[model samples]
Target chain A: MADTTTGQSLGAERTTEIQDAYMAMTRTKRMYGGIMLIVFIALMVSGFMLADSRNAGGFWDGILNIFNFPGEVLKEAGEKITLLPALMVKFFPSLVETINIAAASTLIGGLLAIVLSLLSTRGLARFPRLIGVFRRLMDILRAIPEIVVALVLIFVLGGGPVPAMIAIALHTAGALGKLFSEINENASLKPLEGLESTGATWSQRMLLGVVPQVAPNWLSYALLRFEINIRASAILGFVGSGGIGYDLKNAFSWGQGRYDEVAAIFILLFLTIVFFDQLSSHYRNKLVGKA
Target chain B: MTATAETLPITDLKQSATALIGRKRLLAFATPVVIAAYFVYLFFAFDIPGLVDRARMDNAAILVADSYSYKTHVTHDNRGGGLGFAIEGENKGTYPEGMLPEFVTRTGEDAVDIALKAGESATIEGSTLRYTRPDYGTVTVAVEGRDIILDTPDGTVPDWISASGARVNITGAGGRAVVTRARTEVYRYSMGWELFWFTLDSPFYGKSFGELAGLAFSGERVVADKSNLAAMVHDFWNNAMWRHKDVIWAIFETVLMAFLGTMGAALIALPLAFLAARNFTRLMSVRFAVRRFFDFVRGVDGLIWTIILSRAFGPGPMTGALAILITDSGSFGKMFSEALENVDDKQIEGVTSTGAKPLQRYRFGVIPQVTPVFLSQILYYLESNTRSATVIGAITGGGIGLLLTQAIITQKDWEEVSYYIVLVILMVIAMDWFSGWLRGKLIGRSE
Candidate 1:
């Protein structure tokens, strides 16, 4: 009975020791986390101050006046609300041009992306030795911002939708190529081997064997890209290209009397973007779910 | 009866299969045909043939040539009767008096001989300029009174030479010379970026690499106030032509915008995500409102946000950061809520069983479970936002984008444009590599 009592005591002491060690560990961890949090907060504060100092207007001053421009715009838009419909109608052709730019670029870029993805994917490349070359080409294309290309092209070709289209298409090709190649890597290669055994050409094999399996995912990605391209096209137009954004810039730059036009454009752009966003998400969910 | 039923089902199956195959084949052909038709329509819509005429090939040629090569201008001011030599004819690139490039030799007080490539040499003396081409012999251009006269060995100006009474421009394989009544200018083209490290004012300018290395390591003070190495670095950093310091700062500002924007978005989105997540928030009204807010923010778009913020902030990196933050918060909110909804409940249950309070449960259970997903998404967005920040910067007037646009708008600064483009590309690639590395380090290599 004494020995049993002693054993129980010994077990209790060990449990207390273990608990103390665990508590110490937890304390150390919490202290480390606290220090990290403090450092992060410090970094964020300093960074914010630095950015604020570099800005043209002070943040505190700017914040107070944040609503001034919007208020003026809203007041003007409200007074000339009757002209909104007419302005929208006038900008409809510009909107169509913007959409066409997006659509054409998406289509062309999608096609190029397909070829690039196929050429760069491992175990499926038509020229295995050139896989790295194609991959690097995609990287370079992806790294270049669309504005750089658009501005350069605008210089040579003058300001137009074509420059925006070509610029967006090049970027999309690179962006989509990387994603498509990843999807290609996940696709089954057995069908490709079977096609090759049947003496099918490289293109024939890709079409008959590999493309069917990856088409749904590719289509989904392409749809998403189309939505992004629309935004890019509009932004490019603002920079100096032909589209609704150019009209909006003109209206906005006019400052006061043309706020109605700006308001109408903002409405149109907002609606179009939301519509495409919803449509593409719906299609993407359906594609991925069904697949 | 069994055999008949089986045969009937087989025939039905075969018919359906054949129909499916026929539809597939038709689609296969129709898709490409539709695309081709659209391309044909676009060809006319974009006016491809008209573009051929409208396109400025000379501007493109100049852009390409200027990006790779720089020209030295040897000019004599006829009105002032003084000679000056400058690189690219810019005041900043003017050579100091009595100091000239090896190719240029001062023969007299107002005369200098410029050695061009391919055995071509040009001597500018007062108002008269003489160019000697190995194959074309000698061409003399004199600016006398109001009329500029040009005389070639053949007495007939070739197509390469465009001469008028006021201005005479002679273009040759070696170099180009322009003689006007006000000034006679000779351009000698050279390869590579000149004065990239030091300007004419610096003593270290035009030093050979070996000499520079020797000076750097010898611990001598080239400039009185500073050591040779320090002076070299200071000169390089403050290079007026390259603007390296400003360029670096711009790059940093670009990255800072991305960093602040992405992290700020993630922080703001996290709490909002809890409200939006179906499993976390039981109130339907709250969830609906939050989701709609996310949609509204996203639908407004970054370009619109950038414009709005720039109006308020008056054009800076902060406005860009805010624009990115607002747009990305919408995206992060949606993605984070989805990730939260997908979190396994088992961990939460275990934490609850440990007698952990609600806040502790979340800290120990929910956050740890979703951290990897959160981190990976945030990192990915960080990389993408770097690119977006460049675009936004252009609109808001900050960062390297501002410099790039400024350079491009000048139309003559194609070299600077190319330089900025290369830097932007390198910055993006570096960001990509950094994000990938962080993703691997923080979340392991899932791929």
Candidate 2:
């Protein structure tokens, strides 16, 4: 009876010790979390201050006047609301050019991305030793902001839609290549092995066996990229390439009397983005859901 | 009875299969046809033919050449009767008196001999300039009374030599020489960026690598006030031609924008996600409103948001950050809420069974499950936002993008443009590696 009581007490003491250690760990973790939070807060505050000091206008002053430009634009647009439709019609072709740039880039970029992804993918790579080279190439291609390419091309090719198209296409290829390779990794190798056993060429195997498996995901990604490219192409246009964004910039620079045109372009952009955003999301949902 | 039922289902499947094949065939042919037609239309619309005519191959050649090479200008002022040597003929790049490159030698009081590449040589004597090329005989140019006279060995100039009553230009494989009534100049092209590490004024400007190493290790101070290494660093950092200090600051500012933007967006989106999540907010109206708000924000797009926020915050890193923050918040909100909805109910149930409060339950159960997903998304955006920040910086007149645009705008600073491009590429790749590393550390590597 005495030995049993002592053993029970010893077990009880060990359990209490473990409980104390767990509580201590929890407290230490909370302390670290608190410290991290404080540090993050400090960084944000200081960064904001530094940015404010470097700015042309103070944040507080600018915020107060923030609505001034937009309000003026809205007022003018409201007054000339009748002209808005005609302005939209005038800029519609430019908008079409922007869309075309996006579509063309997506098509071209998607094609290149397919080749690049296959080249970089482990089992699918034709020259596996050069996979690092291809991967780095894609990284560089993706790293280059479209504006950099567009601006440089503008210098070489002159201001036009082609520069923007090429820039967006190059970026899309790199961006999509990375994502596509990820999908390619998950693809079942059974079909690939079967095709290879039948003496199928690499391209044939990829086309017949692998492409079917990943097509849906690739298409879905390409559609999403198209939506993104549209926005990118528009922005590139603002930087001096040709599109509705260029028209918007012209109208914006004119100020006051041209607010109607700006408003029209803004409406078109907003509506188009929303429409494509919804459409792509809906299709992506169906595609992923079915899979 | 079983056979009939099975046959009926098999017939249905066969019919559907045939129909699907037919549709697929139609789509296969129609899609390409449509795409081809669109391309044909685009070819005309974009004016592919006219682009060829509009393209300036000469400008492209100059850009390509200038990006990798620099020229030293040797000039004799006809009016002032003075000799000047400069790199790219810029005032900042002018050599000090009595200081000249090795290729140029002062032969006499009023004469200098320039040793061009490939056995080509040029001599400047008072008002006369003579160039000798191995492939071509000597050509003499004289500036006299508001006119340039060119005397070739054959009395007939080749296509590479362009002469007018007022000016003469001799272009050869080795170098170029131009003589006008006002001045006579010879340009010697050489490989590599000129004075990249050190300028002419620095004590270590033209030192060999071995010498530099020795100086860095044990030599006396290069400057009177500082150590040799410090002086070297100071000179490199303050290099007037490259502006390394400014470039580094700009890079930092770009990263700052991305960090502030991504973190701020995540912080804002986390709470807003709860309101939009169907499982979290019991009120349907609140959820609908928040979801719609996210859609609206996302629809406006980053470009519009940038414009709007720049108006409010003015041009700087802060404006770019805010634009990124506002736009990405919508994305994060939608993604976060979806993640929230997909959370396993058992974890939350266990926490609730412990008599934990709602906040405690979320903190202990929901946050942990979603943290990895949230972190991965945030880090991915942080990488991409670096690139966006560059573009946004271009629009806002800040960061390396501004420097790049400015350099390109100058139309002659292709070297600087190339430099900026290299730096920007390196910055982006670094960010990519960094974010990937962080993601791997935070969440186990996927591959």
Candidate 3:
């Protein structure tokens, strides 16, 4: 008991020293952090002040004249800069359109991924060469960018979210393929063994064994890919694909005093994303048995 | 009687054989039916011909001829060839009236030329003045028989026209002029045509950054590109694309964004993972609720979150970032919580049974056992987060990927467009290497 008391005292003293050092370091960091915060706030305020509606309109007019073709929507984008009321109307619709593009791309991409992903799994020991071929093939597919896929498809289909959808689907397939294989290769062998012992065919054993084991993994990968697809869809719109991104680009190029609206949208977007992310996480946790 | 009973078995066996034959007939009929059904499934599901055609199309781009013309010039005794074309209509529904043509041909010496349209606003003076393309040769036109033969200053027949009715030749310059149809394709929109035979052509994606900034803030009604406008789809994923811009930005805000988004939640649900663990917090009720909660959160998916956010923010980088944040957080949390449940708890008991404070015991006892696992988990999330950051960036208004998106969609500049892809690949590679190094340092460290 005496020895134990002494040990506790020594530990306490060590803790005090560590605490002191930590506090000193924290104070130094706090000073720099405070300065950064102040500077950031100042910059934002100044930018907001410069972003006047009238100024934006004037800027828009200036930009439109340089566009050469007044009838073209993209050329007229400069004209749209700076009108607060009009900005609000156009901004909202474009945002809505962007969401639609993302959502649809994710679902369709996710479905295609499920089929391709199975090929990547190593559970099919009987088809080792096929597994290697598919795994490598998936890697090559995933290696291409969403934009590249979008651009190539655009050459074929012309324009629109269809290209974006293709990009998302290919990406989803590669990503989910890799993920599905990892899950399959790591699944519990006991269940698979039990099925095999019952004289079940290899396919039957796989269905009874690997399918249930990787079900949660499939759900997780699909959800994650959906999130990525959302972002990709929005981006494709910037290239004249006609989504909210098109509106945003026009707003930026017309660069009158509409910076505040951009900031406002940024804030709104952040809040909404945070909310949904929180919600999805809740389900992912349940699947991993970690909630 | 006993002998007769035994003999009765032979008669019964004959009846049984008849029954067996009836069953075989039914099975034979069913087998073909099943085979037919299987083939029908394969045909509809595979769609082999359609897929083959699609693949063929993907490999080659189509070129359409809009409008074309040619010109040739004749000098003293030589012939030269030249040509020109107009690939698109100027808002006149694929055909414009009384419009002048531009030349695609190169200039050569001899010059008597005819514009294919036949009627010219300006009259050509005979003999002295001649027409020629900058790159192609010139053409001489004489009424087929009226001025067909001519003597030059050298007293030789002038070879200023080609043998073919559709071609022209100039003899003095010693060259030929011919006009052929030029092919062009108008993608979904008719902004411009890539020069045929030029594979490097791609969409232009940039203007001045300042110009883009103006369009974003300006009140004027900003119009969108055709590709975007046509994508106004009524679907969940389409909706999410617009919404997730916010999430993308959020993901880029901090490296810790991935961890906190994922594992912080895991920390909060530590008790649940512990309960689910057979050797740890084994209370059935606690385990059940924790498991259920994980399912509920993870079930919905990150895209849904992105969609929801896009609606709220209207669309942009923030939505994409926010989507990343929420997604990473939820996933990391669940992953880490599972690791916790799976951790060794021998030391945990020593501290807990001794009545050490809960926080103290956790810090000193449970932490050591799971330190490697936790560190590895964090590192992996960070690596994955970096890739995710790009995805978020693409949708959001900011990030290098935005430049790439612009290139692919607008300018059609394929060569430089590949630069963006290289950058993304480099980024992912770097992240993988960095995480792997960190993994070694953290998880592979000596106890």
Candidate 4:
């Protein structure tokens, strides 16, 4: 009876020791987290201040006046509501051009990305030794912002949709290459091995074996990239490449009298983006859901 | 009856298999055809032929050459009777009276000798300029009254020389010389960016690295008020031509905008996400409204947001930050809600079983579970938003993008444009690496 009581006391002592050690650990973790949070908050606040001081307009003042421009645009747009449809129609060709740029670039970039991703993937690489080179090449391509390329091309090619298309294509290739390669990593290699045993060529193996496995996911990603490219094309236009954004810039720069046209373009852009966003998301969900 | 049923099932399986294969085959061929057709349509629609015609190959060549090489202009003003040496003909790069490029030497009050590349030489004396090339012989240009005269050895002007009544231009393999009524200017091309370290006004301008190092360590200060190193740093930072200080600040502002926008959005969306989550919110109407709000904001897109915000805020990083914040809040809200819905119910139930209040339960259960996922997503967006910020900055007139656009617009500053491009690329890559590293440290590389 005495020994049993001693054993119970020993159990209680070990449990207390364990509890104390756990509490100490938790306390240290909490303290470290607190320190990190404090540092982060400090950085954020100081960064905001520096940005504000450097900015042309103060944030507090700007916040109060945020709706002024929008209100004016809306009021003007409201007055000339009937012209909105005609203005949208007038800008429809430019919008189509923008969509075409996105589409053509996505197709071309998707093709390039497939080749690049296949070459970089570990199990599927034809020349495994050159995989790093291909990967770095993609990194450089990705690292270059599309506007940089578009602006330079604009200087060379003059204002046109081709430069925007080429710029967005290059960027899309790089971005999709990285993502597609990740997808390639998850793909099973059994098909490739089977093809290899059959004495199939590298291209043949890729087409017949690997592409079949990854095509749906690749298409889904390509669709998402298409949506992104549309936005990029529009932006490139605003910066002087050529699209609806160029038209928007023209109208916006004309100031107060043209707010109706601006509203029209805004609505068209918003609608197109939403339509594509919904379409791509729906398809993406279906593709991934099946997987 | 059993045999008939068995045969029917086998044949049905075979028919379905064949149909599937046929559909796949049709899709394979049709996809490429459609793509090719689309390309054909685009080729005509984008006016590829016109683009080829509109393309300025000369401009491309100039951009390529100017990005790496700089030209020094040696000018002799005929009317004013003044001579000046300038790099790229810019006032900021004007050479002091005593200092000139090694190949250029003053011969008389208004006369100068310029040594061009490949044994070509030019001399400006009085109102006459003479250029001698090994293969092209000698070309003399004289500015007289309002008319410029050109004389070649053969008395036959080659296509390389363009002469008019008021101006005579000689373009040779070595350099270019123009004699006009106002001034006689000779341009000599040299490799590499000049005045990148110090301008002519700085005392440290012509010193070699070794000499500069010695000056830095020497006790004798170059300037009376400051140390040599401090002066050097100050000159380099405030370099009028390159504006290194401004460039650095612009890069910082871009990153700051991105950080503020991304983190601010994540903070704003976290609570909103709980309300949007199906399990957390009971009111269907509330959930529908929130979801629709998220969609509406996201659909408006960053470009429109930037335009609208810049109109009110008037071109700055704050506007860019807010634009990103507003656009990304929608994304974060949707993504975070999805993440919240996927959270394990058992953990929340366990917290509640401990007699924890709603807030405490969330703190102990929900936050811990979602923190890693949320943090990774935020970091990813932070990196991406840095790039977006550069684009938005261009629209909003803030950050490195503003500098880049300004440089590109100048057209003559191709070297500066290239420099900015390099810096922007480096900044993006560095941000990418830093965010990836942080994400890895904070959360295991799940995404």
Residue lDDT tens for model 1, B1-447: 999998998999999999999999999999999999988988887778888888898989999998999998888998889988898999999988777878988888889888998898999888889999897888899887877889999899989889988898988787898888888898989987777789888889989999999999986688988888999999999999989999999988899899889989999999999999999999999999999999999999788888888889987778888899999999999999999999999999999999999999999999999999999999999998898888888889999888988999999988888899999999999999999998998779997
Of 3 and 4, the candidate ahead on DockQ is 4
Candidate 3: regions farther than 4 A off = A1-117, A123-127, A143-148, A151-156, A186-291, B1-363, B391-399, B409-412, B445-447
Model 2: CA > 4 A from native? B1-13
Expressed as tens digits, the lDDT of each residue in A186-223 for candidate 1 is: 99999988998999999999999999999999999999
TM-score against native, each model: 0.96, 0.96, 0.43, 0.97
Clashes of each: 0, 0, 144, 0
Candidate 3 retains true contacts at a fraction of: 0.04
Ranking by lDDT: 4, 1, 2, 3
Cα lDDT, all candidates? 0.91, 0.91, 0.49, 0.92
Highest TM-score scorer: 4
lDDT of 3 by residue, A128-197 (tens): 6687787767765665656656665666555554566567677777767777777777788899788888
lDDT of 3 by residue, B1-447 (tens): 999898899889988998898887787589568756754643453343454454535323321111111112211321322212222221111112332223212233322233322122111232222334333333323323223332134444344533443333343232233221111111112223222211111121223456645644555533344332122121212222122233233323323233333344344544545555545555778767766566554443443354344334433444444456555554555665667767666788788888889788878787777767766766776666655545444553334455555655543244334445655666656666777886776468442
At residue B285, what lDDT does model 4 achieve? 95
Clashing pairs in 1: none
Q: Write the per-residue lDDT of candidate 2 for residues B1-447, one digit (tens) a residue.
A: 999998998999999999999998898789889989988998999988899988888889999999999999999999889899999888777888889999999999879999999899999999899999997779999988877888999999899999989888999888999998889999999999988888887778889989988988986776897888898899989988778899899888898888889999999999999999999999999999999999998888788888777777777888888888999999999999999999999999999999999999999989999999999999999999999999988887778878888999999989999998998899989998999998998788986
